[model samples]
Target chain A: MSKEELRMHWEDSFDHKYVKLKKWLIDGMTNGQFRFGDRLPSENMLCRKFDLSRQTVRRALDELEKEGAIKKVRGSGTFVNRVFAQPQRTSSVGILSTVLYEYIFPTIMFGAENILTSAGYGIEFGITYNKVENEANFLKRMLEINPMGLIIEGSKTNLPAMNVDLFREIQRKGIPVVFIHNQYAELSDIPCIIMDDVGSAFALTELLIQNGHKKIAGIFKFDDVQGKYRYAGYGKALRAHKIPIVDEHVIWFDSYEWLGKEMNWVFEEIAECTAIVCYNDQVCIKVLAEMKRRGLSVPTDISVVSIDDTNLIANLEVGITSAVHPKEIIGEVAAKTLIKMIEDNTVGNKSYSKVMPVEIVVRQSIANRKKMEKHHE
Target chain B: MSKEELRMHWEDSFDHKYVKLKKWLIDGMTNGQFRFGDRLPSENMLCRKFDLSRQTVRRALDELEKEGAIKKVRGSGTFVNRVFAQPQRTSSVGILSTVLYEYIFPTIMFGAENILTSAGYGIEFGITYNKVENEANFLKRMLEINPMGLIIEGSKTNLPAMNVDLFREIQRKGIPVVFIHNQYAELSDIPCIIMDDVGSAFALTELLIQNGHKKIAGIFKFDDVQGKYRYAGYGKALRAHKIPIVDEHVIWFDSYEWLGKEMNWVFEEIAECTAIVCYNDQVCIKVLAEMKRRGLSVPTDISVVSIDDTNLIANLEVGITSAVHPKEIIGEVAAKTLIKMIEDNTVGNKSYSKVMPVEIVVRQSIANRKKMEKHHE
Candidate 1:
């Protein structure tokens, strides 16, 4: 580059609209290099030196403040991030989940954190909570921040196309995005991090069948491919055993529910059903809690099984038995695959699918009905 | 306030970097608005009419995408957010938890979602994960796209201060920030959301005494006031009953188990105590898991009481008894106060410590040691 161009580049770098003044000071200090706890010049001095508005200068300083590059006391002045080094930011990955209100998201997030942190990725999350706009807003925001890779729990539908625009944006920007649960049907070529919902559901249903539970129910929500896959597995298990699919035993809600009224209706309808398998741990908790209220002890008078084991059940007096969702593995795979996608720019390719298996944790929660013929409680 | 200024704002609204050319088309639609499902004009028209580079013109459409405002198919152009009530935003409040990996941060965030969503605020999050620099970066990025408010879980001793400089910048720019856990000690006037650690700790200890467990062990992180409060409370609880504080039973690990191998030595020292009360849930989880490996059962052989009850314990098989932190209330208060700070531009006020009471959940984990002669399976 010419000397003039070099000087121009230097000026442009110094004149960065977002962090102009801070950049200049830090660059100037680069030779002297500000160490931890180095006091920054007062706001007035910075404003005067940069010939920039106080607000513009504040932006750079604020960035510095958040970085702990500097500390600011109300009456006192700004100082530097005392413990900072040349930051090694690679170990951080972003996890974008559906919602924050749902227990499943946080529980699944817990698992993801365990695997990612153990494998050396710091976990950060953006909560979509099933909203397309928020998801898109977060995505646009995410593009600007850019983590190592991203794990996105795909919506059942194609994000109604709008909320999904961010998915395309994620693709266009060459950021890796691994879809969770239902793959982005529209973007079928992208790899997804998933669970063995089909296998886990089949195994749970088989367990119930082996335990002599002929009258059975599969609890789920409508419109989700994951839930649908579980239902299909349930069918596969029942069909193999020569049992007809009972329409009455197929119970579903528009959303996840274990409310007393909802459970009561199910119980009243399927009075003779001996066992129930649920989509996730939440439904299982509700089912058990409702069953207990009705004086129906688990595994004795009635047996209950669920997909998705969570820390929630581990805290219960009677431990819940069921295969847990592979949240961590799925997160890791999703994170890794997304990073790969970002590197390869594989947004338009055939979507990838991942199905992790679940493990049955047996302690209590499920018992054979035949053992309770002459017993109570 | 002036007519010329109003005109400038009107033009600026349309000309700002974020403004999309499609907005102009949408505005020009019949009845001065476009209906849902109405197909937008082609990009050529946008480029020609707006006199913008295709890259610049595409941003307006991009906003709609992330927001799920419009749907786009490959070979097909963009459509609107299908659940589109004519471009309505989903109601959500975003939380910026410092570190997503920590157990306490999740617990607090869980509470924030509970209160905010119920109050008609949608939940979202930006994670600094306790890195002051990362925190600053996220703050700048978040500012670029404003959320309703932010609930922040801050870092502990010697960790980077969150964009304190940026937070002031945020205040200058009229954004609300609720600092939770570690609030700026020097900036007492800054709005913060936190629990009454001392009160709750004292209460937990008192509860143990009331439950008839006197020979107790206290565990906490050495730094941070929360630990100090728990220690003080333990001392207070002991003093209330005229029992001497057992110096040997107090265990503190200051530096990320900077104690590492010596963690065992500390654990061994505390094992002799009959009843153990921990500062928070993570410490409880670690301590309890370690104890079980050593063949000790909870509540029966050694009653363990945990502070900060999360859903993990309530649904746990062992039923860890714990004190509940008012996450939603704290988050709500912090947010409201931050908003106030943002609006008022006030400086130099001490944090109004809102000491909420902690409820002790009587779970099976806290056992009556006198009744257990055998180990729990």
Candidate 2:
């Protein structure tokens, strides 16, 4: 590299450090942490807090002084200027969810980020790992930063939430929050962008019944509202057809209990059933693997159906019948709703909360039980 | 009193004590503070915590066992029954605000309570004393109860908020929250039922300008969004009329700074002005009293205009021109909005967040500068 290029790079680094330190000081004043006439931290203290050199800290302080945001009293240190200490607004929104890489979350995040960034707003992303405690911590951190809006997916929504008070406080502070996927039963007023879980589950179950498959079994997650809604849809479809919901054919497992378990027990409970409805593509893959282990051919010995038409089942010889999750579209809608709330100051409007319809994709997963019996005769 | 009557009264008191203890235990179970199969507190612990006799605590435990909510073993401690330990939904809403007795809050509360109670929903009321810390404490307590919805008047809304995370957590939990009067700038999506401060302030200022008073002085609160909006309207009116705003003639104070202060300095800064615009009727009262102390007559020496045509200024000899505060109407609308959100599950709709229009209540305080000049001629 040329000497000029090296100097430019060094200067850019120097400028970045000072600009960051200057913003910290300004934020302190804007948020009233440093009120007018209040003394600022010493040069040594600033350097330690921001982890910058004394020269960089001095440059930041100098810029503040020049702009009249602070006054330097050589003996007394720096004080916020009574005249120039005013609140500054930020155009950033906080985006929080359970996980980014797992399931369809990456697509959702990508869709939301694209819209928010293009609209000239910065994003502060947070992950909760589906824990209420982590959600509270992230929310607390976000509130301190005071973003203009928020788009969040709830953590363990089917359970009694422990972090709802913090959510209420955020609303009280006038921040617009929009939820994607699921929301807590306690905060139904906050708009949520979600696919029609019940309808999709119903459609998947109906597809199985239409193929002359009766005595069907279902495996569902018990700790999330989405699972409950899907179960309800399955039950509704069964009831509509005058089919008795045999308790022995239904199984429930939470997030932690579903991993690396013996599938023999699950199959044993539903041994007499002709078909099974898995909760999603992820669960369907597990069921398919378990069937293969038992030397059972898909749509020959047993049939399968589920929700979320994701690529997880792409490599399987038989494509499982499933309903679309509307992954990216849900994210885009959530982001758009949040942005509308922010720009229009209509965060209180419940109309923006929407339920997207689902479409089912049929594959070679279900068997024609009636046709097979007639051919045998 | 008869012997039977006296005995009945004693029995009623005893029943109430045991019933309260039973309800407390059920609440703990329903809110997941105690999970299924969790051991119950010892009789001695319950007695001590509830300040009840051992017999009353034992009776409460017996009731739980009879209702199949708990199982008590002869030698072992009592345990929550796995089958019966399910979440029991409450038909109650939490109402939070600052200073229920001050200004128009009592009327607002009355309106909300009337509607909520009539709709068969119970009320949980909390006061914040306009402090964010108190707001947080109340919010935490309310979240534990997990009310169906929340109607809150934000505390210290003009300043940087400290309890917004709690609010966001509540929203994530699916509780609907509505704000009244003022809301924090950070959470603008939470529907707020408020009078149009900007429009009213403009009309009030315009009334002064129409009376031929161009050199106008104004005083506003700086810590509330309402104050900022009112100030905006005042500025807008001045700008529209092509009048330069004299910086020295305007003053801003927060909730804390406005109490028990001398107004001589205020008058000194605006001595040349013929009329002063006050933020609210409360501030106008203070200003009027100061004018009277200085032997200045209303409309003769100086005129005043303000918002909130409340009963606080009813006893004044000279009626000050002001804007009407919706008061109970705001409360009714807030309650209706909350109930709609709860019943229709439309809390995410921004259309419900309303800005109530303001009307000017023409009183006797404005001085006609043109008429006074003609009289002098």
List chain A TM-scores, every candidate, in order: 0.65, 0.76
lDDT of 1 by residue, A1-377 (tens): 65466445646764565455667656644433554445678889866654556887788888877865567878877765442222322445677777854666665666667656766667677876454435556676776665556777754331113344456655544455667777644566666667787788888888888766777887765435576668767867886786656655766553212242257767776787888888888788788878889998876667777777777677877766687776656655665565555445344244555667567777676676545543645
Worst 10 residues of 2 chain B by lDDT: B81-90
Model 1 quality (TM-score): 0.36
Predictions in order: lDDT: 0.62, 0.80
DockQ of each: 0.01, 0.01
What is the two-chain DockQ of model 2? Answer: 0.01
- Candidate 2 stretches with Cα past 4 Å from truth are A1-377, B1-87
Native contact recovery (fnat) for each candidate is 0.00, 0.00
User: What tens-digit string does per-residue lDDT give for candidate 2 at A204-277?
Assistant: 88888877877999887755678767877887787678665665676666554467444787898799999999
Q: Which of the CAPRI classes, incorrect, acceptable, medium or high, describes model 1?
A: incorrect
**Tens digit of lDDT per residue, candidate 1, span B271-300?**
667788887886777776777677777776
lDDT of 2 at A207: 82
Runs off by more than 4 Å, candidate 1: A1-93, A100-124, A143-148, A156-162, A256-261, A315-318, A342-352, A369-377, B1-377
**Cα deviation of A371, candidate 1, in Å:** 6.9
Evaluate model 2: give its TM-score.
0.41
